[model samples]
Target: MMKPVTAQDLQTAGFVPERRRGPAVSVAQATVDAIQTMIRTGHLRPGESLPPQRNLARDLSVSRATLREALSILATIGEITAKPSGRGFVCADPGEKPATPSWRFAARYSLREVYQFRHVVESYAAQLAAIGHTDPELAELRECLQTFRRAALAGDISLYAQADFDFHHLIMRICRNKLLVDMHQTFASILLESQRLPTERRGNLMHAVQEHESILEAIAIRDPEGASYYMRKHISMAGSRAGLPLSELP
Candidate 1:
């Protein structure tokens, strides 16, 4: 059995303790770095629940508030996720290998070109989903819509980004075509970039949430034409908010 690691394990592995006299922000950042090191060193497994807040604060020699700030940052960056039970957070699952190197793809494309591709693929996905999805798939879309709405209202850009992807990916899955799904998966990093671009700018976050809701509403009605039209509108709006010129594709 893998022994459950503790704060002492982290210290034993050379995780540096934050200085009490340091600036609060610096201490918080140091806490984040130490926790990230713990993750890399296998002291903390992906999907493993962290220790209770008080215990972790004591272990790191910082106040619970500072520790919390660090955890929030981790959660935002896809490193960890809040447990469904609400007890605490857990490290995110490390899933299968990507078909391509994400960094290389990001290097190869400008944000402008990426959104153009997204508009083409995602609009088609919404059209197929409107005609082909089962009831359960529709339910899942509704759930993701609610999640995205909550994230937007809270101004959590990270959570919003995740929910945004989930909404689109679900559409692809319901489209029932493996090739479309594969292509979308291959371009995952670029899609993530497009999502980040719109949400990163001020005042665009809520705009995106509203736009997604419109797409979901269209999909829910099983209106293929409406779904495609709304998806195109959503992507176009996102591109505009990101300051990219989206000339209608030929």
Candidate 2:
């Protein structure tokens, strides 16, 4: 049998050390940030119709119910307006500034419920990626690893941050689950944004490398249960560092 992935392997791969700390951002916060960043980066441009509910949930690695909550949160802030329940959300410019107090309040108030929905869906996605990832998709995981290592070696915080973010994205792709990938896509930048907020520069990235390597190993060996366990652990570690529980949220 292949040797289980080890911390040494991760270190040898040039993983950066990281410390974890912060107020756990809710799923709504993550979703809102993603929409903001996409506009900031011009990925969605102006007035783009956000993807359908099912599609958004799949891309963001979240549950449909959880994503709906995020949408409600967004609507409160005037970032996107969707009519009634079950309609699509559309992009609206927040102008030159970040969202106003009303929007911020929605995000702050909805924190617990958001996490409750997200953790459940993310746990499920972990299980799916473990089972359905393809070989090319597997290679993407390695590429993310190597890029992160290079960024760490160069002491490039900005680059390391972006790669670290994409690395998680690769995991969803590796799982070959469209729904999961969609869900993850929805919140892509928000996690990074949260990390930036406290500027918590804990040597926490190394722990992540080791954890990711473990997940990859299970996938390489075609062990679904092992893969799922590791994936959930990985998301949990990040959340825990952010001062949130890894299991079901409140």
Models 1 onward score TM values of 0.56, 0.48
Q: After superposition, how far is residue 194 of candidate 2 from its true place, in Å?
A: 4.0
Q: After superposition, how far is residue 197 of candidate 1 from its true place, in Å?
A: 1.1
lDDT of 1 by residue, 1-250 (tens): 2355566776765555666344533676677777877877787888788888897888877789989877855654446777878679877665721122122345688666777788888899999998888888889998998998898889888898888888888899998889999988887866866676656433325666777778888888889899999898777666655545323221
Worst 10 residues of 1 by lDDT: 96-105
For all candidates in order, the CA lDDT equals 0.73, 0.56
lDDT of 2 by residue, 1-250 (tens): 2123244433343322222213454554455455455545555555677767776565555567766655654554345655447357566655632422121224543433444544565556556766777778778878888887777677676877787768766766665678777867876555455333211422334555676688778777778778767766555444434434223333
Q: Which residue segments of model 1 deviate by more than 4 Å?
A: 1-106, 246-250
lDDT of 1 at 194: 67
